[model samples]
Target: MKSRWLVNLALLLVVAGIVAFLYLKPQEHEETDAVHEVSNLKLADFDRVSIEFPAKAPVVFEKKDGFWYLVQPYAARADQVTVQRIVSIVAAQSHEKLPADDPARFGLDNPRLKIKLNNEEFVFGLYNPVTSEQYVAYKDAVYLLSGLYSETASTQLLEMLDKNPLKPGEEIAGFDFSRLEQWQEVRLQLDKGEDGKWQVSVQNAKPSQDDINEWFDGYWTKIRALSVEPYTPDRRAGYPTFSLKLKDGKQVHFEKLQESPQLILGRPDEGMRYTFPADIGFTMLNPPVGLGK
Candidate 1:
């Protein structure tokens, strides 16, 4: 009888052990039966991005030389932080998933915004008024995601480039200034010689001064806009304008605003424009003069 009781107790203990393993075991390695992928992407793998808008052409940004640069419409510098933000938010997991049975219900038939990240594309659809989330179509799958996708969609081309006329770590080897003065062009420029000295030159005159510090004490150590405002330029409109050509073939073409004292800066090649305070504008316009801040 004792032996039989022992066998029954052993079977009960074995059964309890199996039950504990089946019901009480931690699911550390088991995956939940849910998929929340928005893009199924690793943001680091993408080297290029194109943000497309309904009304405007897509702006392409490429990763080159360890930095992001604009490669469409016009070649220019790109803001790394801006690009990273878009990439990060897009690659994140979708907040919620929804049925994609109806195309017209969520604006999938005509997506207003499209973003091409390397091999994948994100098509933005309607907003979920109830959840405050957005609908995005990727491949044939649709997901309800955060509304942050619109942030990248609404970005302007000029917003991608560095606002400063002179990028950090860039030193100008020469600067050529010219403007239409009463239908005649007047040119004044300054060049840095191999000896690392500055020289000033005017129309038909040889370089006379080697010192530029006499202008603003020490402004050439850094040349930047105190602040900038975006403005669209009239490409064909011929008015009195000036050009400050840098060593890298990029030039700042600008003209004084007609109604205001502010100076309008233009990148003719890129068709981008910016405005600067009159005080700062005149300083950049006349390089040989004092520009003390």
Candidate 2:
């Protein structure tokens, strides 16, 4: 009887040990299942989204032609980067504790911008709790809110280049009068040397070979960095317009004929006309218009 009782006690201890081991082990298999479930979500599930901005307007985007396009106020160009960012935000898993009574608090309100998917639109409205004043919408959604402004800046500068009349070896005749601080201190003269090389000189100073090359390269750099912003049209009256003196020795004086900033090349008789989007250009040292502060 003593040996049998000892054996029964040993069996009970073994069963208890097995139960504790099973309970203490990590749930590795369960975690693997959870990860697989999240990874299985399909991108095609979200076909449409809508974005509405505060106080301004709402935009709807549809995936057509294998790309997204804005359908409201005429089919305008859509920024692809903007679309991708919105889609990613919408598709991301929400883990934050949602408000019990109001989900709209976390919804689109006082948003910097809004985007719309296929059937549903994500609205963004700004809520200034401190100021009590909210600006709901951006004026030009495509141009103002989207990242395409950089591209627009480049295009505008290129357009302005089209109106300029400067050439490789063409001279622009103008005397630098220090007394009249209305124009640039140095006058530019372009000439071709006997060696068939382009030369740019300022006044009587003969530019070194390195100086000429540097100046030429600098001009191109300035052209690339050009940008335009909104300016007051009325400020044209304060600007001093330059009078072009052509190589042919004819003077063409320009008054602020149009409020728009433009690159006036050559003498009025023989020159090219280039107009920038705004008054900001290399020639104008002080930008005339305030670019939205």
Candidate 3:
């Protein structure tokens, strides 16, 4: 009888161990599933997106270049800071639930801005679904409000000024002198005329020496503060180009393709070759003229 009891006890212990193992296995699986769900969330995947503004234009950003460019009307560079701000705002709120009805309150009226997802594009219009209010789209979201046009004018003006300068000689080509105070004081000399020719003379052209310098300094300070850090190209795109905006709101644009980058400035065409400083901004205006044809 005692031997029979021992066998029965061993069987009960084995059954209890199996039941415990089965119960703990599911809890481990549940914990693993929770971690996996959180890991799958990502925001950078939507980094490259497009935004459109009504009565204005459309802008596209490519992840490879990490720069924003205007898409519609014409292909042009977009404001870097503006693109960054929009991306940041959108990515932060990706997981939030969007509200229905008066979505314009969130800046969705007019539905001007469109965002491109992996395989889909979302459009947000500017308009008051119930009332007649203007709307603006930013990032991947929208907002309903007025005063959109006021900001648009200033924004477009800055974009135009950035691309073209107001230098005296060039017609379509120009530099915006809105920022001119950042450069250190450099000497300027003009040669005296010999009978019908000119001569060279150096004058005290310090920042304190002329009112023009003071005005220019102030203008440059403002521009530098607002302007984005200039981008450096990996390789030489073409001949080196130089643009200088004078204190008088005049611009001088020059280009030379010789082995060295040189620029000639001033009227009667003074031969001045500026060795571009790394800090000073540089940009390419056109393709190479004569080399390796």
Candidate 4:
């Protein structure tokens, strides 16, 4: 009788262990199952992005040498933050996924916005009134994603432009004031000497080291334009040219497009036009002069 009782107790303990394991096993799956991926691609995997809206021009961006550039609607440097924000859609997560059969129910039949990351296309549909999450269609599946993704891609093309005329990481080595009228009759050429001191071609134009450094570091290097537009030069018009030499042995040329209400400088090679307030523009075009600050 005692032997029979021991067998029954052992069977009860074994059953409890199996029950506990079964209960804990589903919890592990629940943790992983809760996260549903909308796209398998990461943000870095995308080399190009195309955004389209209803009744408007489509904007396109391409990554080159680890830097993003606006390739369509005109070529110019891209705002890195904005481009990264738009690219983040590929990393979005979905809480629910539905069949693409009833696309009209989710407004996928006539998507409000369409964005393409490389060859993968994502179409934005109507928002869920309860959650405010947007429905996006990719491949044969429809996913509910954050509305921020759609809002980011629906921006004006101008907002996508980098306000700075110069590319990131470009080091200025010198300035060529030969095209623009310099002090007196002397056209100035300024370059960084081997010892890292700024050297001017003409002796009479020597300014204090502090003043020169301030203009180069505190001003020109930190220059930000009020706005930018696609540059289209008129063949009949004469444009004054200015140039900036980079430490990388590349020279960037700029054409003075306007000088009135607002000063406009056009980078012909980049097809970009940078506009600045008259006072600021004057400061950028003219360097500091004299020995005292």
Best by TM-score: 4
After TM-score superposition, the amount by which residue 167's alpha carbon in candidate 4 deviates from its true location, in angstroms, is 3.6
Each candidate structure's count of clashing pairs: 1, 25, 30, 0
Listed in order, each prediction's TM-score against the native is 0.54, 0.30, 0.32, 0.79
Task: Single out the weakest 10-residue window by summed lDDT for candidate 4.
Answer: 26-35
lDDT winner, 1 or 4: 4
lDDT of 3 at 239: 38
Global lDDT of each candidate:
0.66, 0.39, 0.38, 0.84
Best by lDDT: 4
- Which lDDT value does model 4 have at 125? 95
10 residues in a row with least lDDT, candidate 3:
282-291
Question: Mind sharing the TM-score for model 3?
Answer: 0.32
Model 3 over residues 236-259: C-alpha lDDT tens digits? Answer: 545344455444445564443232
What is the per-residue lDDT of model 1 for residues 1-293, given as tens digits with 9 covering 90 to 100?
99999999999999999998989877678756575877656768888988888887778889986777788866776777778877775566765676777778899888878888886787788998998888888766688777776765577666666666555454566655645452234455666677866765544444325346455334445555533444566657775675555567566555544414776666554445556677766665555522222
Model 2: per-residue lDDT, tens digit, 91-201? 333212222233245333334555544443333333435543322222212111222322222222223222233332334343222222333454333443556344443
lDDT of 2: 0.39
Question: Residue 155 CA error for candidate 4 (Å)?
Answer: 1.3
Q: Candidate 4 clash total? A: 0
lDDT, candidate 3, equals 0.38
User: Over 4 Å off in model 1, which ranges?
Assistant: 1-37, 54-56, 73-76, 99-102, 139-141, 167-169, 173-260, 266-273, 285-293
